[model samples]
Target: MDERDRAIIRELQANARLTNRQLAARVDLAPSSSSVRTRALEERGIITGYHAQVDLDRVGRGVQALIAFQVRPLSRDVIRSFEAFALQQREVLSVFVIGGGDDFLVHVAVPAVADMHALLMDRFSKRKEVVGFRTSLVYDHTHRWTVEPVIED
Candidate 1:
């Protein structure tokens, strides 16, 4: 992709609701050309599906935590099982099968600290593969929607 394509992606990332005319104006391209480029980008999988960013607290999930786990006998089966179980859980927002000292990083949102404790004691503690785990309460979370990866010449 060229500079114009990158610009188009940036604008869309900022606000996916922009019309073809608006996007074209921002990227200094004609409406038809912008639409074509956008469609091509989507077809090529560079532009994925759009989604609304929701506030967890507003939706009754006030408590957020990142639970890190260290699995015993870290086999592929054990990892996959845990990942699948976590994905099926209602409280789990996202899961990362990470490396380093920890095996998995699970982001969860719940109603309260008591609910989080219940989840840890009831759900995770029952898992045979889990050797140890730690929870860190999230006070604030911020992320950027518009990200342009550095391209080398």
Candidate 2:
């Protein structure tokens, strides 16, 4: 992508609600050209989706925790199954599969600490694949929404 493409992406990242005319104006492109470029970007999969950011605390899910788990067998099938299971859980926010002492790290949010404990005992600990796990409470979380592409040398 060139400078115009990058500018378009950057502006969209800041506010996906921008109208085509607004976006074109910001990127200094004609309206038709901007629309075509944006469509092409979406078709190429560079722009995947738009989302609404929600506050867990305001939504009644105030508690957050990162739970690291070590699953048995460590096969591709087992990993995939575990990931799918985590995603299906209501309390789970995100899951990460990594190569390290732990096989998976799951981010969960609940109403209270007791709820989190219950989830660990009733759900995660009961899973046959789960052998070991650790939990850390999340006090705060921050994210960088806008990103610029890195040109590889």
Candidate 3:
């Protein structure tokens, strides 16, 4: 992509709700040209879907925890089963299968500590594939919503 395309992507990443005219102004392109470029970016799969950032604390699920798991028999079937089970759970926010001491890292949010305990003992601990696990409560969370790919010189 050219400098104009990069500019358009950067502006959009900062604010996906920007109008074509506003985006064009920020990127120094004509409104019609900006619209066409945006459409082209979407068609090329460079621009994906937009999303809203929700505050987890404002929601009922204020308590967040990261549960790391070590599964037994480290096979594909066991891993897939564990992943499917975690995804079906309501409290689970995200799951990551990693290559480390822990096989999986599960992110969950709930209203209370009791809910987290129940989810651990009743759900994950009860699974035959789960050999061991550790839970760590999250005191704070922060993330960057907009990210730009580094351009090589």
Candidate 4:
């Protein structure tokens, strides 16, 4: 991708609601040219799907926590099954499988602290694969919506 492509991606990341004309103007490109470039980016799988940010408090899920888990029998099937189970849960927001002391990291949101605890005890603890887990309450969290590409020299 060139400078124009990067600029388009940067602007889109900030606000995906921007109109074609507005985006073209900001990136200093003709509307048709911008459209073509955007389409090409999508075709190349660089520009994935757009997303909306929601307020957890307004949605009745104010409490948030990151739970790191260590599951027994480190196998591909076991790992995939755990990931699928986590994603299927209503309170789960995101799940990550990483190569470290922890096998999985699950981000969850609940109506209250007590609810989070209940979920951990009722759901996670019940799972036979789960050997150990730790929970860390999220007091304040900030996510950078806009991502800047790192160009190699």
TM per prediction: 0.87, 0.90, 0.82, 0.89
RMSD per model, one decimal: 2.1, 2.0, 2.4, 1.9
List the candidate numbers ranked by TM-score, top first: 2, 4, 1, 3
**Which has the better TM-score: candidate 1, or candidate 2?**
2
Candidate 4 per-residue lDDT, tens place, 57-126, comes to: 8999989999999998999999999999999999999999978899999999999999998999999999
Off by over 4 Å in 3: 142-153
Model 1 lDDT per residue over 40-97, tens place: 9999998988878778889999899999999988999999999999999999999999
CA lDDT of each prediction against the hidden true structure: 0.92, 0.92, 0.91, 0.92
Tell me the lDDT of candidate 1: 0.92
What is the clash count of model 2? Answer: 0
**Number of backbone clashes in candidate 4:** 0
Q: Point out where model 2 deviates above 4 Å.
A: 142-153
